[model samples]
Structures are given as structure tokens and as C-alpha cells.
Target: MGMAAVIYMILSFYISNKRLRYYYRFVSLLAAYGLIMSGTRGAMIVPLGGVAMFILLNKNTRYIVGGAICLLFIYVFFAQTHILDSNRQIHRMRTAFHPEKDASYLVRKANQKRLAEYMVHKPFGEGVGLAGMEGRRFSRRFTTDIPTDSHYVNIWVQFGIVGLCLHIAILLFVIGYSAYLIMFRIQNRELKGMLIAMNCGLWGIMLSAYGNNFFWQYPTGYIVYIFQTFLVLGKSYDKELAEQTKLEPI
Candidate 1:
């Protein structure tokens, strides 16, 4: 929700009406507060990833430099120092930066290795609903007992390398196509910003999905679908905006 609000806040700036724009920004900020309180490590990536992508897509050099500095400071605070360790939320978020030292991460890694060995001969995976807890419930013929903590891992174990690779290829294509459209095709500045913001949010969510199944879950799934719809509609939006601009009274 916070991630979605942050995207809305970014788009709200392009809104023409002063009152509506301010209301959107103010409400988004209020909603963004939930991001901190939730303490879900993966959720932290949404904004950070969005900012990074924004820097790349946006041509504003000054803002890019400023964003870079902020990102650097965040990295130092989260990965290098324990300055905010006293704060429970901050401490939990920091763990995401130090995967080697995180016990749960290590466990997940070990489980992945075990799964890899077990599924080495099965290139197409043991089959759907047959690799994790669901697999155990269905059958033990080739079930993996370790918990499927990450969606990627779950996909890999169930679909095998072939399936995983195909899935990733599709994601890469979507990201690449959207980026190309944003950079070269989209002409409306506001539309460009909105599209880039969505791209960034998705990039973050895709990466974070490795930690949890954000793609199939509530809100994120809907958000992803909606974003894709807009992404493919970029040309139409640009044309509409161009028409609207021409028709506006000078």
C-alpha cells in the first residue's frame, strides 16, 4: 500500500489542479507511513528501487545526483553501520542488506542447494503443487520438505530450470519493452514520469518477489496487471495527450 501510494505521490505532481494535487500528495505521505510500521524487509525495496530507476529514466542531472547521494547514505546506514539498531523496524530492514549474516537467508540458501541436487535430473521440475508443502500434501514421491520461503525458489523447484528461465525471460522482455517505450516513444512528460514510476515500482517488486510471492498475492498482483495494461497503452496515451495539448486554449 505504501509503495502504491509513493507511486501515486509521484504521479500526483503531474496533476494540474492544485487542490487535487496537494490532496493526493498529502494522503500518499500519510499512507507511506505504513511502510515503516509494517516492518516487512522486502517492502523497503519498493521505494529504494523506484528511486534508483527514476534516476536512470529521468534526465534531471541535479536530481539524479541528489538521489544518488541519498541512496548512498541509505546503503551506508543499512549495510555498514548500526546507528539505528535500537529501532526495531530499522533493525529488521537492515537484515535484508546482510544476507550472509541473516540466519533465515542462510537456511533458505541451504534449502535451495538441496533442491538443486534433488531436481538435477528433473529439468521440467517435479511438477506443479509437488515441490514444497503443497507437494507433501499431494504426494511424497519427489516432494521437498524444506519450506518454500521465496517465490523464485518455489517456481524453480516446481517448474525446473526450463520453467524458471522462461519465466525470467518473459519478465525481462516486459521490462525492456516498457523501458524502450518510456525513453523513445512516450512524448508527454507527465505520462513519461508516470510510466517510469510504474517501471521502478515493478522492478523493486520483481526483485522483492524473490523474498516472497508478491506477484501472485493481493494488491501487488493487481498493481502489476494494471501497470502492464498502462505500459502497453503508452502509445495511445501519448497520442491522446498530444491531441489534448493541441486543443488547449493558448
Candidate 2:
């Protein structure tokens, strides 16, 4: 789920030839399938978010318009329709739109409320690993007894409001910086496309994290860190490639 956009973004952007592009297109579609099958509601939206960013950042107005129209149709037809009415995975994802009707959502909400009341006394939190699964594994604490479903909630419980603010600040900075690079600095189409995709992918993960503790979870966490590195170093990669291109004619 976390890696879906990473794979699709990289494959979709590094198109140097028709055959390669065709291959990427095929694999990217497959990644989309993997997202749907993963059954993680929040993760499934990452690809579409990445695609939206790709189109919006594209230099071509025609592509932007066409892509927007295509998205509208998909939302109206598939998301709003009962085409996959019988598919449990699809049904679960649809629950995202109606949290009031979602059992899991209600449970998470109740858990969040309980945690909030508990936090009124401990402003600095109970400290990391003292709550949630880590807390249970290591020892018992007041927080350990409480259930937290969201990653953000986990952070809040462990680090308190201060930690949560700092965490959010860091994320906003990365996302903002990435957008700045794509819109103003990056000249290479491939790099720009990949960065856009990564930005959207990160957004998906963050938004979904409200329901699932994914930031520190396996695969998703690893993929996110790697993509962050890729995004931050993208400018360096561009410079190095440019130098290589200049030397190629020598």
C-alpha cells in the first residue's frame, strides 16, 4: 500500500523509449490492482492521488484538462456507482466516504476520545514505547491499557501535543519543499513527474494514517523514507545527469 505510488511513479516517469513506456504502463496498472487487493482502504487512494499530481504538474494544458475530465468520470462512474457492489474490498473503501456508517471508524473514534480524556492529565504524554503495542510488550502503563488506532494518535500518546506539532511541521516542510522543487526548480520532465507522484503518494499515506498506524509500519515506513531521500536528492540527480549529458558529446 505505501509502496504502490513509489513503484508506479518511478516506472511511469522513466520512459525513455516506447517499449519501456509500454512496460511501465502495464506494471503501473498492475500496481493499481495491487492497491485494490491490499484491502487497506487509505492505501488504495494513493495511486489516484499520484496521477492527479502528475497531471496537474504537467506542462501540457491539454493533458491537464483531459486528466481532470477522466478523473471526474471515474469518480462519478465507479466511486459513486455500485459496479463493484458485491466486492468486499470495494465496499470497505467506500466506507471512507461515510465514516458514520463504518464500524472500524466508530471504534477508532471511541478509542481516540478515550485517549484524549486520558491525555488531559498527562500533557507531555506517557513517553514512547509506554503505550500501545510497544508499551504492552515492554511493561504496563496507564497509556498501555488504552487502544490507539491511528499513527498520529500513537505519536500524540507517546510524545504529547508538542511532539505532534513538531511531527506535523516536519511533514509539511518536506511536502512543501517537494512541491517547490517540482513547480520551480526541476526542469527534467521525468524527475518532475516522479516528484509530483511522490508528493501525492505521501499525502495519501498521511491522510490514511488517521485510520491506520502506517508511518512506522513495515514496507510503508521503509518505502516512505526511501522516497523522501529520493525527493530531497532529486536535484542532485538532475545536476549529475546534466553533467553527464554535456560530457557525452565530448
- Global lDDT of each model? 0.79, 0.73
Candidate 2 structure quality by residue, lDDT tens digits, 64-143 = 78768866875775557777768897777676656677788788788788888889877777787876765798778778
lDDT by residue for model 1 (1-250), tens: 5467557666775667789788878877776678878877777777788778767876778768977997899899999999979999889989989888989888878877888788899889878887667578777764556777777888888898899999888877777898889989998877887888788778777777787755767867788878878887888999999999999999
The regions of model 1 sitting more than 4 angstroms off are 141-144, 247-250
Please provide TM-scores, in order, for all candidate models, with all chains considered together: 0.89, 0.87
Q: In candidate 1, how many clashes are counted?
A: 0
Tell me which residue pairs clash in candidate 2: none
RMSD of each: 2.2, 2.4
**Candidate no. 1 TM-score:** 0.89
